[model samples]
Target: MSRKLAKEISWLLVTIALLTMFSPHTADALTITTTRKLVVLDPGHGGKDTGISSTTGILEKRIVLKLARMTSKLLSDQYRSLLTRTTDTDLSETDRATFANQNKADLFLSLHLHAGKNKGFFFYFDTPDNTPATNETTWKTQGLIHRDKNRQTAELFAKNSQTRNKKVKTHFAPAPVISLEGLQMTAILTEPFTITDIPGTAAEQDAFLAPYAKTLARCIETYFENKF
Candidate 1:
C-alpha cells in the first residue's frame, strides 16, 4: 500500500486495536470473513439538486462525488464497488435504492454532507418497514432482513469513527434507524462532516475531506471483517 493508504488504514486499525484491548470478549466473538463484498457508493443530490454549499463556494454534490471516488479507491483492494451516478445527473431516492437492489450490492452507502455548526460524522440505517411486501416472496422480505444488517453496520461505523475523531474534538451521534424505501440490501446514510464547518482555503478543503474518506473506507473494512 502507498503511504497515504497505509495512513488511512492505520488510522482505523489503531482505534480498533484500542477497542479490542478494552473489550476482548466482544472482539473475540467477531467472525472474520475472507469473502469479497460489493459496496455501492451513492453520491447524494446530483445535477440540479445540489445538496449544500461550503463557505469556500464548494458544492455538496461535487464534494460527495469526490469523497465516494476516494473511498472506493481505498476499498478497491478488498471489495468490489460501484457508484450510483458517475456524473452530475439527477437521480431520485427510489432510483438510487433500486439500482443497488438490482445490482445486488452487499452494502449501500449513501453519502451526504450536512450543513450545520457542529462537525463530525452522523449515520442512519433504514428504519422499520411499514410498507407491505409486494408479494409473499423471498425477495420482498430481503429488504426487511437487510434492515437489521444495516443497523449493525451503522453501529460499527459509529463506534470506529467516534474513536478516530476523538482527538479532533469531533462528535458522532448514535446511529438512528430511519425510513428509506426501495432498498433490497443493507444500507446506511452518512453525513461525514458539515459543509460550512470546513476550514482553510479552497485547496485546503480537500485536506479536510481526505481523513473522512479514509475513515469511511476503514469503517467499511471493519464492517466486513466482523460480518460473515
Candidate 2:
C-alpha cells in the first residue's frame, strides 16, 4: 500500500476511536428537546348533570365544553392540551383525576360555569389530605407534594384573569369540595362566568366565552413562564 493511503487509513481509525470514546448516547448527553407543558382541561358536568340553567335555556355543561375546546385550541402551539371529555358524557371526579394523573399532566384545570346571580371568575385549588408516607409504595397516596404548586398556578390564573373592568375571585376548599383529589399534579378549577346572570341575549354568551377562553390560555402561558 502507498504511504499516503496508509496515513489516511490511520487517521480514519483514530477518528473512529475518538468518536466511540465520546458517544452522544451517554446519560449526560441526553436532554429534553421539547419544553411544551402538558395541560389537562376538564369540562365539568355533562349528560344527566345539566349543571345550571339559564333563562335563555343555555346549559352549563354545553357552555363549559365549548369554552374548554376553544381554550385547548388556543394553547395547542404552546402546550399539550388534553380534555377529559370531548362530548356530552358524565365523568366522575375520580375518573377525571385519574385521567390527568394517567396522562402525567403538568397541570389540571377544571372548567366550570356557575349558577348564580353573580358574574365573576372563581379559581379553586385542591386542599389535599394528609401527607403521604415517604415510601416508594405510598408516593401516589397523597398530593402533599403538589399542594404548593397547585396553589401557585391557581393564584397566577386569578391574577392574570383579573382586570380593571373584571375581578377574579379565589376559593380554597378540600378535595371533596372541589373534586381535585387523587391528582398528582397541580390542579385548579375555574368558574369564568355565570350563564344564569348574563346581561345580554343568549347568543351573547358565545362572545363572553371567547374572551374568557383567551384569558385562560394567557393565564396558562403566564403560569408556565413563571414556573420554569
Candidate 3:
C-alpha cells in the first residue's frame, strides 16, 4: 500500500481502539449488593428505674424487659438480631444508640411499656431535634435516612397489629431531642401497652402486648428481607 494510505489505515485503527477502550460496555459501573441486616433491640428502663406501676403492681420496666427478651428470642430463631440490654440493667439512651451504631445494626428498636393512663400501643419515631444529642449535622448526615427507615418499620408494625385487634399509634417527637439523641441514630420507642393505675386494665394490657413480641419479630424479619 502507498505510505499515505498506510498512515490513514493506522489512524483509523487507533481511533477505533480508543473508542472501544472508552466505550460504555468497557466502563466500570457501581454494583450494590445488599445483604441481610442485623438489628439491635433496646429494652428500656431496668433495675433501678421500675418505670410506671400498674394497679396489680406490675412494673413497666419488667414488662418491657420480658417482652424484649421474647422478641429477641423470636428474632434470633427466625432472623438476625442483637440486644443492647438483655437483663435488668439501667442504660442511658445515648449508650443504647451508640451500641447500635457500634454494632452496625441495620435497625434499632427501643421497647417499653407505657403508663400515664394510656390504653394501647404507641409507636414513637424520632424528630430531628427531640434529644439534646441531636444536631443539624448529625440529622443531615445520619438521622434522616435512619428516621425514614424507622418510620417505615413502625408503619409495618401498625399494619400487622390489625390481625389481633390491637391498634398502633405513631407519634413523632415534638422536638428532635424529645426521645433520644435524635441525630446519631434511627430508633423507635414502642409502648406496646400501658400498665395502668386503673382497674381491669391488666388483662387488657396483656391482651394487647402478648402478640406484640411476635408481631415485632415479624416486622423486623419483613423489614430486613425487603431491605436486602
Candidate 4:
C-alpha cells in the first residue's frame, strides 16, 4: 500500500477511537433531553394562617392541603409534582412563587377553598400587561408576562370541571389574586369548591376530593401534551 493511503487510514482510526471514548456522554445527554415537566402545587394558608374555620371542626388550610396531596399523587405517573408545604406550616404567597421559580417549574397552581353555600369553582389569572416589558418588571410583576398561558390553563381546568360535573358552575376570569401574584411561570389560583356545602363527615369529603383530584391531574397532563 502507498504511504499516503496508510496515513489516511491511521487518521480515520484515531477519529473513531475518540468518538467511542465520548459516546457514553452523548448517550447521557440524549437520555436527559426530554425531561418530565415539573409542577408546583401550593396549598393556600397554613400554621397561624388557619384560613376559614367552621364550628364543625373543619379548616380551610387542612382542606386545601389534602386536595394538593391527592392531586400530586394523581400526577405522579407522568410528571414531577411538588407542594410548597407538605405539613401544616407557614408559607407566604411570595415564598410559594419563589419555590416554583427556583425549581424551574413548568406550571404553578395555588389551590384554595372558600366558605359559601354555592357549589362552584373560581379560576383566576393575572391580566396580561400590553405595556412593553421594562426594568420595572421584576419578580414582583413576573406573572404579567405569563398571563396568557395562565388564562389558557385556567380555562382548561374550568372546561374540565364542567365536563366532570355539568351541574356545577365554573368561572375563569382575569382577576389576579395575592396567591397567584409574583409568579415567573404560568400560574392559576383556583377555589375549586366551597366547603360550606361539602356535606357529611371528613371521610365523605375525601371521597368528594378523589374524583376532583383526578380531574385536576388530567387537565395538567393535557397541558404538558399541548406544550410539547
Choose the strongest candidate by TM-score.
4
Task: List ranges where model 1 is wrong by over 4 Å.
Answer: 1-35, 125-143, 167-179, 199-202
Quick one: ranking by TM-score, best first? 4, 2, 1, 3
Evaluated at residue 213, the lDDT of candidate 4 is 87
Worst 10 residues of 2 by lDDT: 26-35
Error of 1 at 164 (Å): 1.1
Candidate 1: count the clashes. 1
- Stretch of 10 with least lDDT, candidate 4: 124-133
For model 4, the superposed segments whose C-alpha errors exceed 4 Å read 1-34, 127-135
lDDT (Cα, tens digit) per residue for candidate 1, span 1-228: 899999999999999889888996765555333245888999998989998887677788988998898899888476778999989999987788778888878888888888765555545442253443445534434455555566667677777877777643344333433323456776777787778866656567678778888899998888777873
lDDT of 3 by residue, 63-138 (tens): 7776777787777443567787778888776677778777777777777766644344435445454543234545
On residues 79-153, what C-alpha lDDT tens digit does candidate 4 reach at each position? 889999999999888789889989989988888887765455555555465444355776666767776777788
List, residue by residue over 57-138, the lDDT tens digit for candidate 2: 7788888898999898887465778999999999998888889989888888898877654444444433345444343534
CA RMSD for every model? 14.5, 9.6, 13.5, 9.1
Q: List the residue pairs that clash in candidate 2.
A: none
Candidate 2 is scored at a TM of 0.72
Between candidates 2 and 3, name the one with more favorable lDDT: 2
